[model samples]
Target: MRGRLLALLIAIELPIGCVTVLTAATAYRTIMGDIEASQVQTTDDFAVRMRVWYRGALRSLLSFGATVSEAALPPELCGQAGLKMLDRARGFSAVLVRSADGRLCSAALDPGIDAQVLERTAASMRASPPVAPWKGVDLGAARYGQASIGDRRYLAVHAQNPAATGQDMQEALLLVAPAVLESVLDLGRGSKGMDIALVAPDGGIVANRGDTPPEAWLPRESRPPAELDRWHAADREGTERTYAARTIAEPGFYVIATFNDPHERDALIQLAVFLLAPLATLSLLCLVYLRAIDRHCVRWLRSIETAARSRSSSKRARAAMADDMPSDIRSVAEAFNAMVDEQEVRQRRLQTALDDNRFLVRELHHRVKNSLQVVQSYIGLSKRDYQDEARTALADAECRVHVLSAAYRFTLADGEMQPVRVDLFLEDVVSMIANLIRRRDQWISSRIETAATLSVDRIIPLGFLVADVASRVLRSTPGARITLSVVDLDEATIEVALEADREVAHQEPPRLFAGLLAQIEAVQSGPAEGRSLGRWRVRHHG
Candidate 1:
């Protein structure tokens, strides 16, 4: 029972655990996939917005470039044009116009630089935005560049301007501060924890939100990715991140977006908790249910089982426990106790009735023996008045009475419930008969080869018959040997044999003993006169 209950609890709890784990695992895949896709969309939107911002900024910068390069502009005219450019476009922090010979001819917004920044900016702009190389007095098509001037990052647009001096051309440089890129990123960042970067083909970060350069985010992605590619890679901190790349301004620039990986595991854990709490509560409730059954039912059953195992017939029975039990259990205990007590009471009454029966049976046997003895006494007294044969007849009658008396004594007083054992009755009856005729040198031997018993009524008559036959045999042939036996032939039958050896002429059995023969169902197969005699045997039910 204990094992079954434990198995039942396991049967309930195991499925709950398996389902929780499977559900969490499946949900982790599905939800994380959605989260990754959402993050990719974030980067995509930011790339689109950055592309739009660049187009407007480049157009306005180009218009200002046209203004300055309509003719050769002096320092004052360049300054006024640059100030107006700043007022028109908040994205522009400063501007520089330099001649094709690499001399700084003009500056705006209190710019604190030599001309070397513009020269290097022009030299690196060849691949991106497809700008041509500078020739003597003729700079190629316009292009944008991201450069560092004195540790500060700037985005610059450079274009050729028409100059009156044939070998002299003009180059325009526009500087954008880091603060402007940050504001653009703010517009694209959503609830998703996203990081974005504008990357150049030279493995340089054009603009990014974090301190780590964008190319280091995926060291293997230093080469340009195809348009709108997505992959998983590790960042500079040796942690994995999901990255998506979109070509924004192609000739080798792209927008790279990374899904924040540090938070992924934590997010999955939170989702698992959201699914696990209710199931955990259900598991706890199952435990509580098992506890309640033990408290209310199983404990009571255990007590009843203990009592039942210890019950004995010879000793008083133990009652089932009932104290402080639930009403249902108490009722069962009460019924069990009542049943045990009733059986005990019935057993005691039965024992008392048996005792009473023993007393009555013993008294009856005693009185019966006394009556037979009195009859023997009267026959012995009557022998005084009889002659030889008559006196011998009287003695035979006296011996038969003595046999009847012995029969009564051999039987049990209190054991009247069962039949008399045939062997015991034969032994005692044959002994008494031999003793009664001992002076005649006659003795009877008796035996029963198998076990059998008979009712008192059937057994007492056989004793009388055996005693009378032995007396007659001794009278007819002095010193006769008589033998008696009862043998079991089968479960339902027995054979009683009485035999006497005779050296004299054989005599017939007397008619006077016919009544005894009929009473015991004993048969006489011999003639009334002289007959050969070796044995007298009877077969009957055991």
Candidate 2:
């Protein structure tokens, strides 16, 4: 009897054990998935914002490009051009313009720059683009700006403004600065608690976020995806993160966006485990109890029946049956039946919930898509009446709205963003901008160096800013070459330069542009500045 009872107990407990283990596993998986999804969404948001700021800076610079290009440079105007470049040196650590054949045009050196060394730097600057700072022709040992303007030997990263294709191949605009500063500024460094950086493929930091000491930043080494077997990484302060990388539209560059947050998949896993564990435990206990009842009560009842059959039938037989049959068996059976009934009810509720949740998810997707379309419509309408400067502003606003829509659409399509690939995101942005620019302007020729791609986070502002600058320059300088180049100036930095005509004059004195450049410098937590000529040199039209 005892053995039968024990068997019943064991059976009751088996279900509980199974439920516990299964619930735990399910819960863990769900949570992990949620974390990944959340990370992706967060990273996407960051990328969008970063792109916005970058655009602002680029626009300010483009304004300068346009104004400069329009002016017809005379021998006298070259000095003013040099001075104007020197004044606009707020975000840039250094500004130097060189001719196509490598002659120094105009330059503003940051304090401690050796005039002699700068001359040497200028010579090397005239050389073809260096494949890498270390591998390229040395401009002689010179102090890099970050370590000390005069203390550390550093290589200069160069940028150029070329005459529009087929116009003047021999004329070019040159710019050079410390690669580290440019990288830091582009990462949106001034925002407190936000750590942005560029990491080399070999696990070196190209630049630390502005404001944070290099030592305080974590080493690029010892970061994530133990189980991922070679996945790109994005993490927050040692916690798990979701990140995406895209090669910069610029050749030979990469950009990444990262975020740390919980994903929906994690919630699903938690819900599963929460409900499953208790049910399994109850099932296990019930099985054990049933086993005990079977051994002690059912077995005894069977024995009594056998003995009664062997004896003469009478009241004694009935009495023997009553005495031998364990009442516990009836009690246990009743309870088991009650439990099965309860489980059936619970199952029905679960099914209803699942159905409702499915409906809700579908509805959510629909609403998000509608919302994005509406936003795009609004921006388009607003852009219709604006012109000149106002048009530029409107265009930027529209671009941002489009970006927001893209974010939502991306999420809806994937159910969540994950391991966000920055290059892909940037490629989309570039295509969109290029199409918009091409479609919008028939008179002015605009070229997008779609070849350079940056992380989506970086792209948000950088792309827009680049476009804005180009547009402004095209508008201001009617017949000037505008070349936009993005290249690694060093292992840890990237730089952009705009060179336009020295004689180009703005309808307005560009006081506002100057101020804007200052603002960009302040916010970027990096060096930046601007200058404008009061007049342009002419052919002495008699």
Candidate 3:
């Protein structure tokens, strides 16, 4: 609450720094568009090489098949011709011809031919025959045949031709070695942060750029992004990363160009540029603005706060703030001064009220004394002209009047606004009643048992009730001692009972009944232990 001016300055300047930092970070990704463009161009070059490699294998095999069949070579002579073909095959691993029933007959290679791998590749090409390319290295009548077996990497190129017997067509598979695949990938790439992989259609990685495995760019559990764009996947180490994957050389085999995430490096670069940007200027501007606020605005507000908190009754702190200030802040100071002036005016009015109350008290005391004398005169006249019942009624009336007068005088004397003590009020009522006993033999005594206070609104009614009941007992049975039991019923209520012996005053109060005084909630007619004639329950009021 006290730092509102400082907070306002913070609210203004903080957003500028935040928006600048965020926009700069977003601009970093916009810069990544260039790196992504580099990767796309690299993959285009790699895909062209993949096409040459796939189609070149077929052209060489077709040449071998025609050379063997044109010489009327039998199944046994096919090995001699394939051996001659292998010498000029470049990176070819093995060239094998299989009989249509699928067992191998002739083979030529550096090591023994993998007849089973060739048979499997032939079967795979039969099941999922590939569509041929529309352009670039379309070898005539060459069907796609590639496979990844165990740790061996190769592309199987198959061609079918007659054995010169013309009974059935024989299948020949030419396997391109790993080195040949590497040369195809090594052809060209004009990009950074990119690695190339020749993945078989069955998702086996055959040849790649380095040992960092294609698994490092993309995890096994994740599918690549649908477009040539960024995706989130974890590496082999289970650390999260971001990369881009684009498929080249499609359909027959996937030339998936995988890129390592270079975002951390990019971010470092961006941070350096951001530090050199207008960010320092923004910070300096904020500092300057905050200092200006503290100098011009906050200084005046704090001085106004000091003036408001001053303890002097004379209100001399109004000049603490200088007159020269901003128009808005000056209005606040003026409001503070106006509130102080109002408070001072209220103080003088309260003092005047206190003086009036003192004069009122003096006049009240004189009137109460005269009223008691008039009550005494009425009692004298009732004794001479009336019977015993009427005289007793006048005496009860006189005691009730006295109780009210004493409560009023006690409440008004030197009082501001405070609750009247029940014990003190009852003591005064009881003392007045004791003085009322005229006969030498008749006497009144009391024991007040509780100490509580109530507002004057409740105290006056309570005093009237106590005096009314006590007067009944004293008048009905002369010389009967009175015990005023003032006990707490609960936290919110108090009970008063006049316990006496040999009194015919068990009837309910006629003048001041329970409902007549809203403060006294109820009346008890019967004595619990055969002593009290009447008991009144008074609820405490604020």
Q: Model 2 over residues 68-180: C-alpha lDDT tens digits?
A: 44443442474467556656654444334334333433444455653355555555544543222222343222211112245543323433445433211122223334452
Per-model TM-score, in order, reads 0.53, 0.35, 0.48
What are the per-residue Cα lDDT tens digits for candidate 3 across 1-542?
Answer: 32675577568657876877788777776677666666666665666676666667777776665555455467567766676677777777777665444334456474544556557766776565444453765544345545666666566776654332442336667877777778767734343556667665556676778546676764546443343545556666786655545443344355566566476577668866774465678667767877887888778878886776773654566835565798888888888788778887897899899889866866775577567667766775666676667766666676777766676666665644467788888888878777663345555555665666787667777777767666666666656777776778777677777777554546556854554456645456445345666666766653
Query: Candidate 1 clashing pairs?
Result: none
Q: Which candidate, 1 or 2, has the higher lDDT?
A: 1
Q: Given candidate 3, what's the lDDT at residue 275?
A: 48
Candidate 1: tens digits of C-alpha lDDT, residues 1-542:
65687789778778877787787778777877777776667767877887667665656665665566555577677667777778677767676665555434444453655445555666665445553332233234566557777767777666655442432446566777767876887733243556677776566777777545565565453556676778887677677777887776545667887765545777678667956885788778778878988888888888877777767543565655646789888888888888878887997999999888887977787888899989989998998898778877887788778767766766654545356677877887777666555445766787778667666676777777677666667777767776676666568666666666554455565675676666766565443333233333444555
Clashes of each: 0, 62, 0
Best by TM-score: 1
Tell me model 2's lDDT, rounded to 2 decimals.
0.44
Candidates' C-alpha lDDT = 0.67, 0.44, 0.64
Q: How much is 475 displaced in model 3, in angstroms?
A: 3.8
